[model samples]
Target: MVAPLSAWPWENFGRFKYLLYGPFLAKVVRSRFQEDGPEDSNWCLHILIICALRGLIHQLWSSYSNMLFLKRNRRIVHQGVDFKQIDMEWDWDNFIILQALIASIACYIFPFLENLPLWNTKGFIALLTLHMAVSEPLYYWMHRCFHGNHLFTHYHYLHHSSPVPQPFTAGNATLLEHLVLTGIIGIPILGASLMGYGSISMIYAYVLIFDFLRCLGHCNVEVVPYQIFETIPFLRYLIYTPTYHSLHHQDMRTNFCLFMPLFDSFWKTLNGKSWELHKKISSNLGKSARVPDFVFLAHVVDVSAALHAPFVFRSFAAMPFSTNLLLIPLWPGTLSVVLMMWAWSKTFVYSFYQLRGRLHQTWVVPRCGFQYFLPFASEGINKHIEQAILRADKLGVKVISLAALNKNEALNGGGTLFVNNHPNLKVRVVHGNTLTAAVILNDLPKDVEEVFLTGATSKLGRAIALYLCRRRVRVLMLTTSGERFQKVQKEAPMDCQSNLVQVTKHQAARNCKTWIVGKWITPRQQSWAPRGTHFHQFVVPPILPIRRDCIYSDLAAMRLPDDVQELGCCEYTMERGVVHACHAGGVVHLLEGWTHHEVGAIDVDRIDLVWDSALKHGIRPVSSTKAKTSQ
Candidate 1:
């Protein structure tokens, strides 16, 4: 439980804490518009810009540090950041807002601070000197004091609570700790100002460098090459590396320096293995990569959805995904990134988690979902998927599951094209449609006699229809092609074939309570279902809920078993710890050690087998509420 005094005043405000800056923004706007404004000359505006810049710096570092492609071998912490840590560090920049408010008040009270010049060499030098002489030592000792029994429990424990530190960890602290940090940080700027030499540039330079070093230390990736320290032995003591600070988190008694290790050396508190461990880690940076036992191959949904990738926004990706105002400004840059990915056209690892000591990773194709629907994009999309499958085979991956449109029948024939092209391949290619069909099938009440199926001729649709008919349940297969419908109908037993009925319009399902939706449906089409009808969806970008009186299920998904570890990211809009059914299908395949390639059309015979195997392995459905609502 949090001590009431240690918690931030706006702790419960969540994303709305940005509103704390509203007053400062309103004042700046008033100053700009009013004819007789306080002549501070937009200093407040400059402060806001600098604050934003600091936030951007932290965001960039978080993205870069978590990028598995860039520095997999050099990652100091092998585990991913979980939702709990993301929430704890969500308000990492609260101090920046608090300081901005304080600075605004200060400018109002002080006269000489009205219109400082842009640059002052003397002030810059003075602040740097003060930082080295006064700030560093004071922070070193204060940081050590926080490690003591009393303060550690009361305040500093919050900082160390993040076992796998990221850039934001630098500023995630209790309110009391932040207050001390604010004072420690302000010393140099105030000292410079008091000594009659201060400039806007100096202020910017000092605070940026301070934040840069702080984030650098906490970023779990080892970025600074070891050669720099070896070349100048003195510089080793003068500056601290990311590895040096990571050691402090590992063993709290050593390496308590701020940005400089000189203070730690003076007190014999520096860890001896810092240099050696850093060199060992840095030497292996790009020479090797981690090979996973299972890989779930996925594609982007759209430009906005791409931002939810693990490497983009840590906090946004940790939660059940949604479109919010935060994504609007990032759209243009993300669109550029998407275009670049298309040009590059390579598969890259997106995120990973471990279950029972086996590694499971999600790798993404460069193509978006909409691109797969285009006539010309099919060849390029297949090329990327094929290359990814071949790459996984070469890397000794055990099983690779195709997700979303990556396994589309029109695109790669449900991943059969690649498997047939490379018969000698050892890795199993799975479309995961077996488990997908099973999830959607099992979600219906066991007594559900009739289910209206759309997209009835598609791979999943065909499998679902055959499986239900074999159970002697009535299946309304909605498809325009009678030939395709007959093809699926023949797959069922002769006695059960009579249970499968062909329907050309949604009007046929008006009386059915269990509607299995396999294709996109508009409000008009959906209105055909009766008032209590439950819409079980296997569609991409799930259909909107237009019927307030009806229930709508999320896309087929399963919650991972409790033994899974480091599962920090939600799969698309799935809730935390839950993954799309196909992704879970791949996981089940790996666990069962099933040698057969599960591509092409799903086997109706194995639907019950796969569903039972998934249950045995503890992968379960999304909760009733999560499955029943679009949220």
Candidate 2:
């Protein structure tokens, strides 16, 4: 019988996804904590880490080696390179690894490159001969073919454009060319050994030597002794010269052998070349990577975190207290109502989402409602909170803060969780500099609808409650804390929107099917929105609000959503590819709020029962409430 077929073959294929995000994430952690030590040490560490990683990965993937061999991500190079030679054009690292990625994956699906019988199982020498005869020739030939397709220049040009190649520059290629290269280079080895012309282990070694030498061939060294090469003609016969490889970058038509001078000799494309561009290429690369010794991942994290201050301010500002107002004169009595739900928070949340950087990464695009195997979000939940705000038809949600409400002269400690004589709800803003979350609560709203919650007295929670606590509106909180946080999944709170029949959050209330979230959060969360209902309850964000006076940066990854057909008068039209880090003199975009949530209220009179509900769930009410009863 023929050998067994693979059942769950691609299962381990997920390993490839790791490389896509692993380095950036590692870089983030390293940047935040570890300094890269000395330059020589840094190089040594990188080399060691790579070598160790390669060994472990190869072993771990050996059983599933067939799959890893085929994947686009499994690589011999430190990084990927895009095919574009124009240094200014490549937006990020993914473009660099394009070739190796394309090649690896194709081999997984179709092991075509070294497909010849009798070449496998004959042992090391036979395997070496077959690999040398086939894989090298194929790599050279296809490497040459990639140059001919002018329209295909996007893939090939990027490879040669690296006048100075870094370890990371190895993987770069246009996605398509990556696939082509993988097919030509990887398949033949697998196919040949399968036909029994040689042993797989020998072929493996040959492939390793070929790759290691090729990398060394692109040297940034000035110490190569041309005198020795001139002395040993047989050595010239044995090894590929540094100048020979660099010449390929200069002229695409010749010098294609990646291993020995086999293909070049057979095809009459060999030249006795020498290494001279070493210093120039190294200098160029050094100048180009001038982004402070930190890895690119560090830069991205810096940008994303740097963006948080504005996002936080904008999100906090869109509070009902500031955005909407229904001065009920500290009175009571209101009718069952219709809520005018306009999320004042649209811009801020969208801006935060856009600037969060993780969304702009390659992973978010496919998230148009699909379970993509994100490299970074493996175990973490979404970090950003999502919610909706409902404004009553005649009774809009008003807001204040804990610090503003309490007027606590308790600038020096010592205070109990006291319930005050506030009518509607108290929005408290913090002012003082005390420890235990410096927030105070007082002065309330009346006839408020029910109050919806993601969790408890997170200082800001009291401020939000005071803004929306109208008299009769009910308050229902899906407690997000401790054990409860684990129970309340990301979708749990978003699902609260459905629990809300006639309540809305947000003050600059525009009519929309959306909810605004307060600072309600949980333990398990990722940088992106979680894949749950508390998340689904949040509305799909409209594209970011771009305006003319504002300079739009990060446009390479920006575009209109797929659904919008009519190109209405958008204030900012992305006319060309965005050159990143372009200094914008002023505020870029007017952000509203990132995570919007629903708001409602239970009568403060019934708030005792609410306390009971909270206490029963082991959650103390956000702030103690003193209500006027029907006495």
Candidate 3:
């Protein structure tokens, strides 16, 4: 049986009115024969074209608008929003095609009944009122259901994946989820038509308006004027703005309603910060914005202390619990147990902080200790380093300095693994070893004709050795392996190798005037140095203590200027207070906006330039020797 025309008051319009409703009339005539059955190819095709066109238009308009706004006022743009996520991939393209097909099929089956005189004012009002009254309640529940743990993981999580929602993200959903959403909107229109309360014109208008609002809600950019809501308090309840919808994406538990906040308010799921966030974003309209420049310094944890204390405490406690149970006094046994408990407690607390991914902020730069022990290039250490990089990226940090172990882990290709793994990451990673080498080389005493270089196999160690050799200083290379030492000597220039003297024994370094310990030097090794020898300890998590007779210095520290120095909240210490030369390299790169600098081995000639850039950003190097001497 044929579906009857919608018996609305607007249907009373004469045939002449059909000119104003040409598309609807044409659809009606084309759909007449297939009305006897549910299957209507002509009606389905028309609906598909309409929906596709609507989607296309929304995409084009939103993209154009975003480009214009970004060019004019970039500061107002959401920093967290990675536009790379919005690019159409194979899966996204397939999902969009499926959604369009499903929506078209659903629309043809539960079609909005036709009516004449398309522009009747009374009918339009009634249609919108019924649509809102029905759709809002249904959508609110459906959306809430989508947020349920099981459903969200399987279906709705895709849509919420973009923390900063964009216009394209509005329709990015699973096929079943999209069908449910489309049904919520289409059902109300169909019900209005079935009840003879809606004209074809009214249904068309609702669909167009709904599509427009849907796009606006997910645009990330807040377009609603703050004055409108302040002037008309009730309007907030009636209309859901872009900021209102963005909060829903950020936090799925609240703001469930699609178009209006009436249901959300009644249900008390409305986000409290929605209005505040909206106002904050709105205030940035038309303002110029730029990404803030900052450096992320990855610090090393004292692994030897962490490892040794635990082992010693465990051994001491074991004596009490085992063979020494009878030999040891009761007080000694109790003390050993107490010490073990304290050591384990400390380790547990420190481990908790590491797992928490806490970032320590300084006046000029941010630091995060990987909280791992030395020999930092293991799989476990690399994982933590990756986490640190990810954390830096999330903080909107533009550049990251791989300090200490971090540099070793990222040394080969300069964090190429991280760069490859995290394609969406905007933060640049640097090994900063070049600048560290520069600082050490520049500070080398001119009078010292001979220098002992240890850990020559390492990237930083080799770089420093070559730099010293270039300065015509005689280099005594000390390492555990004689073969590796010879390999390092072979790789150096003829003139550099001519000055290199490989020494397998630590005692061989005694006669050297300057001891440049790059890495792998323990306190025992440090003791091998003769009294009054100039000792430069460059390894992070410094293994050697300050000696009264020896001239001891750590890595060169960055000195901050007076004005910008006040910006950081944390105080600097000799060990932690001064930024390492490696970290300063990254800070300079960020401040200069130079993306192409070689991270692992920065040009030695650029040392002064990098140092100047660091100073410009308020980072100055304090003498490590001076700081140690005062202590």
What is the TM-score (0 to 1) of candidate 2? 0.30
For candidate 3, the 10 contiguous residues with the lowest summed lDDT are 347-356
Q: Which residue pairs show collisions in model 1? A: none
Which tens-of-lDDT digit does each residue in 1-631 have in candidate 2? 2112211222244436336534434544565565872222322233234334433332222212112112212212212221222232222234223433343344345443324232344556555565577767787777777678763354566666675442223444555554554554455555554555544345445545544554445532222345555577556545665445656666667777766765787888765443334323323333332111000000111111221121122212122112222324211211111011011112011111122121111101101112112445321211110111111101121221111111222211111121122222222211211111111111122333443443233323332333333323333433434443333222223434233232222221222211123332232221122121111111111113122221111111122222222111111121212111110100011011212111221122333332233223222212222221221
Identify the candidate with maximal TM-score.
1
Question: Where does candidate 2 stray beyond 4 Å?
Answer: 1-16, 19-122, 149-154, 197-200, 222-224, 271-631
Question: Estimated TM-score per prediction?
Answer: 0.95, 0.30, 0.43
What does the lDDT come to for candidate 2? 0.31
TM-score order of candidates, top first: 1, 3, 2
In order, candidate lDDTs are 0.87, 0.31, 0.58
Q: How far is candidate 1 from the true structure (C-alpha RMSD, Å)?
A: 2.3
Winner by TM-score between candidate 3 and candidate 1: 1
lDDT of 3 by residue, 526-602 (tens): 77877777777676645556565677775566644343321211112333234567656765666677775345444
Error of 3 at 567 (Å): 3.1
- Candidate 3 C-alpha error for residue 241, in Å: 23
